[model samples]
Target chain A: MRIAYIKNKLLTIDESFVFRVKYQTNNSILSTIESEIDTVLSVEHSEVLGALRNNDLENEAIYIFREVAAQFERPVLLFSGGKDSITLVRLAQKAFFPAKIPFPLLHIDTGHNFPETIAFRDKLVKELGVELIVRNVQDSIDQGKVVEESGKYASRNTLQTTTLLDAIEEFKFDACIGGARRDEEKARAKERVFSVRDDFGQWDEKNQRPEVFDMLNGQIELGQNVRVFPISNWTELDVWSYIQKENIEIPSIYFAHKRKIFLRDGFIWSAEDDVVFRAEDEVVEERMVRFRTVGDMSCTAAVLSEADTIEKVVGEIRESKISERGARIDDKRSEAAMEKRKQQGYF
Target chain B: MEVLKIATAGSVDDGKSTLIGRLLYDTKSLTDDKLEAIEKTSKQKGYDYLDFSLVTDGLVAEREQGITIDVAHIYFSTPNKSYIIADTPGHVEYTRNMVTGASTSQAAIILIDARKGVIEQTNRHFFINNLLRIKDVIVAVNKMDLVDFSEARYQEIKSDFEELMGKRDYQDQKITFIPVSALKGDNVVNRSENMTWYKGQTLLEHFEALDKEDVYNVGTPRFPVQYVIRPKTEEFHDFRGFAGKVYGGELSVGDEVVVLPSMTKSRIKEIYFYDKKYQTATRRSSVTITLEDEVNVSRGDMLVKVGDLPTVNKEFTATISWMDSQNLNLGNKYVLQHGVNKVLAKVENIHHKIEPDYSGVDESVNSLAMNDIALVTFRLNKPIFYDTFKEHRTNGSFILIDNQTNNTAGVGFIE
Candidate 1:
């Protein structure tokens, strides 16, 4: 044990070089040309279009899903009406395929959610036949656990953390899987796959467990839990492409639709509902707008689009220059708004 | 398209973040909103050039100090492939962060300041890449414009690095050298006009031509059971599938298998990747495997072909990279996690600490501090089936957790 990496005796010849060795030994396995071809075939075996395309991400995601099932006593998926969470449900289904998804679905409904999104969420849950636990921000407000903010720039987005933490405590969920991709925001870029949270659900950004290989450390104490992000590597385009490839159903708000909207601070706000804080001077108008991220109505801003179908939506996403997080008004409050929110355990 | 994960290393002021930002900028990966934000921040900071570091240094303290504090992952793509760059801080204090960044990375870019030539930081960076066994390494000699795009300076640095590369055990690693200025955007995505004497593919070109097969190793198949799917539903009453991801080689439907610890033999009854059944489970594919016999198998139990058994031992020697504030001394107990398996382990003996600069090893050290890399032996409460790190990447590695703090204290590669 008293040594370094170089202290190893040169590796023995017990590796797959055995194929070449077999080729040398009487060539019984193949003809010279075939064996030469066999070596290349053995090296790659024509990777079935890719493990990189979506297969690798899909496989890696499924791996995380199973880890949560095995390592944690109780795990629940944080499903919103967004395409990312919807994709997570599909991955979870495949991870356990033929077997019902082991965990329940938790939606921290801000209560300001779009009517269409809530409808979509219920339908998907019904279709999956999994238990749905809906905890409301309105309930938190009613219970005096949180106070709703006022003013034009205010949103119920930050209040969801209180409800989320409460729900985690109530359910005693040791693992809460979310569809957080690293590409979404700057602070999220440094987050680990199996992110550990304290009893308060606070994230210690300065100190996180180092993840390596395909290994994830799910070890934690009694009061602490892990936030698992299976698709942390997937980009927004990758999500859409996967949805397109798998033909997974999503909330109708993602595609183009006519909606009453108002313009504020270079953002498109849905004027159909009075949930969002809007000034009187802000004139309402009709636009073919689609929601880029399906947060609650108060925070989520729609993107102007004419892409009604999935193919067109995928194409639009590929061509869209602005990031998905750019459309979320909650993030516009400050540069470190997400960091602060995450430190307080906002998923 | 393939996704290439790359790690970047450079000392403070070496422009590692700047190089990553330049890559994203040249690839048109930065959205207009992000660019506008950078412009606004740069203006307020009174900088003539865009402060690209603002894009990656996400934490408040990092921005205040104007230095990267941890590993930040940045995503971009070319027409050929998608790329994820893990930007790691290069200061000696962030050795653990750099090692963590390099562990998941398939390739690494060791940034060398052109004017400074090969420094001590370069040696550590290269040493980390070698320790992690990164298959492909690109030594980008940054800030060539400041040296008047001198080929002589780049060559001098390249030769020095090549000399250091001789000390690594991963002799099969591919190393390429390129000269560029990250701020001026030279040889990162496109060839630099300042260095006409240097004739080679740009840094992007080298990556585009990199095949995924070359980055990952394919070896004998090893499947570590993560969970057992027992669907007692009436539709499949007898259905009991071993859910796990296949590593190394392929596992066919009829392949005879052995469950670890149980030593029970069974034949694969079926292989399912999602709903569809396949004859073979290719390497790295997550699938549900059903055995012909109903032998006892649970999470943490490994399934492999009978002839390809790994080393099952309660005691083993390993190289550990300690990452904790508390010192790791002899007889310290930890929760040793080897793949899906967890076993209580106590340090049997302390070995020599290996310096990342490849200088030498300290044989007399009995304790490991933060960021200390050493070879130590451990005695486990139960035997874990494992492989040499040189043979299998996933099966050969494990992490140590101090039960008191629940902090991942150290990571080890089996010897």
Candidate 2:
């Protein structure tokens, strides 16, 4: 492997192409193809290396992804209307261009989402012309599957797990390609790119097998599903970099804007007219803010920031001391909030 | 900015959560809203000192019980590196959670109470770090004020830990000790005058000194085929691509490669990162590659360079960390997931149970229990391509899922 990389570098410097052939004579399908390559003397295809120093990172990901897409009968792209997922969509499109996305896109709606995020999600799905399956918390509540709690602190963050599981079962999606980045949470940091979920969608954190290198084991029986995160190794900065480079379109709520908000816990709670259970004693006022994360509006709090553009937002986040989830009220509800939700199948 | 994955482990009441909260607070990682929430909750609960545990203990049951139940991933960042700290439960019963947290981290922070010095939890914390082969271990002797800022006590604890270090097999690991108070402003991010006797760097200063090379250099490269993208369109006519993350090493266009299981040989025709092409694909970066020939490669099949062949065997020995309630017995069938491939495996035999307290092995143990770490052997229905966990961390480990419950029951490091 080292020699091949060196040869490629040398070829670039010398501008002289030298192809390496497998020396092994094993009587297998791979050896037969190698012999054919040796007969040709020289092999050629699209060999343009990325300008970025980190080209090697992108190239290997593309290769592994194509391999997994071919093996699964039904694989669904887990679209969350997030920047990371947007990058996955673009990468997936390039993976199989002109053929259209082979799988459907799945979204588990919390019913407490920001209007702008919902609008953008619908627009992207329409433009892509791909199948979109949205499972709702409202449906779950209507069926008495998950009760809707009322009050100023009410949130549907945990209920999304049940809706997501229901959607997977309804579609029989064996593979779910998510946009979850390992850098976001500790539970997520331990997650595999191809994490196995039982029929109930529980993630067994303690017994997770170490995912070495790029080999994603996609072996599971019927009724079992695998959550595939292509950007498992990507950090928040990486996602921001990709968004900036790709010039990807995001919801306006990510940018700075003035809105009627109240300070309940230091976070700016949007005093939107549609929101329910707002205490009269809670004071509401306008504030300059933008959301660091876009989740269920009731649970997702906005940060005070003047960084309207992507560049400034990235710059601000770089120097900021607090974490993205620090403003997330749902997680602030308790210490083990994320772990408890994950045990019950929360993504 | 690069994202750094880290994990924190310690015994119960080591103020692991407090230390984490302090880090976030001192770094200004907490937003104004979060601070207010903490204050309101603290006032409501009638606690004098703000409870940082509330920030990490996300579950109601955990907050009520005043302990962490499982793993909670907390994200914070400096301009240099964005950090994700997996705060795992410290109770002895949740050993599996500690393993889970440390598995993905490049760095680990093991907390030790200065008052109690090194205790049983310290051994478990160090054991998990060594087993996971985490390159960097930060031993933060927290609650320095409780020990009266005693330099002698700090030195004693440090020497005691150095003795325990004798047992670790991975010598490349670097260990650093720092004394700090999580409650008051101390040597976490800022150097402390309280510890005038000590002259080492602060916790954050030490973190700033970490180089990128020390973080990601795990082991050999292993590329497990994720999905195959074949855009057999009219314009391109034929584009057969293999998509996956590059592990261990990089793959370039025109590299001699062998498709595993089938053993079909081919050269990397092209490497694509989105629309652009790349000369090589580095480890951990996800990309697609088209082969020179139209060879058949599918998911679960690996594409590795011929010279660096991993172990392709039907049976092997491994250290099994049992994580479920049901006892692991011989003849039990389980689905063994190794890398991106899975094979039907059965428990062949139990070699012996290694006691958790760094004692001698239990040779006569019949079954393994929850939080039990033991050596065992297995027989696979089909040959699994693997490597010794020490040689290649990515290719050398696997997890066993119980056939009956579909629960991940055991994690195995290939021997």
Interface RMSD of each: 7.4, 9.1
Model 1, span B1-415: residue lDDT tens: 3678999999999898889889989999999999999999999999999989889999998998989999899998765677899899999878888888898889999999999989999988988898888999999999998999898888888898889988997898999999999999999998888899889988999998887677998878999999999888899898999999898888887899999999999999888777766667877889989999989999999999999999999999999989899999999999999988899999999879996566999899889999889999999999999999899888899999889988888899999
Top DockQ prediction, candidate number: 1
- Global Cα lDDT for candidate 2: 0.76
Cα deviation of B391 in candidate 1 (Å)?
Answer: 1.0
True contacts kept of each: 0.54, 0.30
Cα lDDT tens digits, model 2, A260-304, are 888776667888846534678989888889987887788778889
Which candidate wins on lDDT?
A: 1
How high a TM-score does candidate 1 get? Answer: 0.92
Q: Which 10 consecutive positions of candidate 1 chain B have the poorest summed lDDT?
A: B273-282
Q: Go through the candidates in order and give each one's C-alpha lDDT.
A: 0.87, 0.76
Candidate 2 predicts chain B with a TM-score of 0.98
